[model samples]
Target: MLIDIFHDTVCPWCRIGKKHLFDALAQRQEQEVHIRWHPFLLDNTVPAEGYEFRSFMQNRKGIKAEEIQQIFDNAQRAGEAAGVKLDFDKIRLAVNTKLSHQLIALAPANVKNDVVEAIYQAYFEDGLNIGNFDVIVAIGTAYQMDASELKSQLNDRAVSDAVIAESTFARLNGINSVPFFVINDKVKVNGSHSVEVFLETLNRAALLDIPAKI
Candidate 1:
């Protein structure tokens, strides 16, 4: 089974969703499951010039800082339960995730989970500027990716354009919200559902023995 995940690194729910999926996968790694990541930029239309994270949240969602913090806390606790340590307080900027998404898009299918985890940690725990090339360069280096090669790919328009195009395609597929999952391009599990729900879905799919339908 191949899972297509439409998500953004800065999204708390996406991070939580990833953790749950990972936990479920860890329990069932002996099964056949492959994952591919796709970009679902939460605010794709936002100008390249980034805004303050809180201001953007307040303006768009009408969420006060307290509400955001409360939400973050809930997500953080969930993450811990799933064996992922998420640090929200250190996040200083919500730069456009276009570049980060591009990097993920370019990563090979086998190493994609690690690439996605790196992006999540870079944005949440490390508080690194994921939107910046320098930060991405460092992230690639840490992941044992050749920094210059990845950097060169960033400058190339093909990868970024493909990521942006996919982001739009996901929206057109009725994905108004993300952490949208497409298993085998047939099973569509949208948004953050329970780990039990995800585990059941995967197990049922596995029982199908060939292709899965959702």
Candidate 2:
């Protein structure tokens, strides 16, 4: 089975959705599943250097500091339930995800998922600036991607354009949110659904893939 996962590296809910999807897949170990990670930029206008995390979110949401804290508390609780850690306080910037997406696109299939997971960990857990070239390079290298080659590709104009194009494609396809999924090119699951929901969707898609009896 092939699952196309549209998500942003900096999205806490995307991480939770990922956990749910994997948890569902774990229940069906007999089937072979391939994941294709696609980019979805939550805020494309964030400058290359990025914005001050707290202020940016507050301004964008038009919420007071206390209200923002409440939002964080909600996200933290959701993350905990999904078995994903979200250290929102550690986040210093809300960065443009173009470079990070390009890095993921350049990765080999075998370790691509690993690269994705590491990027999420670096951003959401470690609060590292994933939009930074050096930080992305570090994540790439950890997954055995050639450092010099990775840097070169990241600097390539075409690579960056391709990442943007993919995000645009998602938007054109009516995917206006992160953590959206397409299963087996037939089942469409939106949002960060629960493990049970994912499992049911997976089973339904799998059944749909079966050949009809004569």
Candidate 3:
């Protein structure tokens, strides 16, 4: 089955959703699944340098102090439930993830999952700035991708364009949220649903005729 996940690195729900999907796949050990990560920019207009995390939440997202605290608290609980650690306090920046998306696009299929997980861990778990080129290069090197080659590819115009194109396609398809799952292009599951929901969707998709691609 082909599982295309539309997500952004900085999205807390995306992180949680990925963990749930992985858990679901693990339970279905006999199934063969091809997972693909699609890019979705939460804020395409963010500057290359990005914005201060708290300030952006307050100014741009209009989240007040108490509401932000509640959000973080809920996110922490969700992360714990998903077996993913989220260090919200350590995060200092909410960055533009265009370059990170490009890097994922350039990664080989076998290593793409690892790359995506690493990006989520780096940003949400460790509170690192994934928008920085150095951070992204380090991640690629850790995954055994050539540092120089990965860096080159990340800066390539074609690679960047491909990431943008994918995002545009998602927007055109009326998917304006992250952590949206399209199973075999026949079933669409939105948000951070439970593992059971994903497995059920997979089962349902298997019974239907493959839909024509959009």
Question: What TM-score do all the candidates reach, one by one?
Answer: 0.90, 0.96, 0.95
What lDDT does candidate 3 reach at residue 201? Answer: 77
By TM-score, rank the candidates, best first: 2, 3, 1
The sequence of per-residue lDDT tens digits that candidate 1 reaches over residues 1-214 is: 7788889988878988887777777788787777777888887666554667666766687888889878778888877876677787787666789988988877766776888888888888887778888877777777777888988998998888888899899889798887888776666787777789888878776666656433
Segments in model 1 whose C-alpha atoms lie over 4 Å from true places: 46-49, 210-214
lDDT of 2 by residue, 115-144 (tens): 888998998889888899999999999988
10 residues in a row with least lDDT, candidate 1: 205-214
State the TM-score for model 3: 0.95
Most accurate candidate by TM-score:
2
RMSD of each: 2.4, 2.8, 1.7
lDDT of each: 0.79, 0.90, 0.88
Stretches off by above 4 angstroms in model 3 are 209-214
> After TM-score superposition, what is the CA distance of residue 69 in candidate 3 from its true location, in Å?
1.4
Q: How many residue pairs clash in each candidate?
A: 0, 0, 0
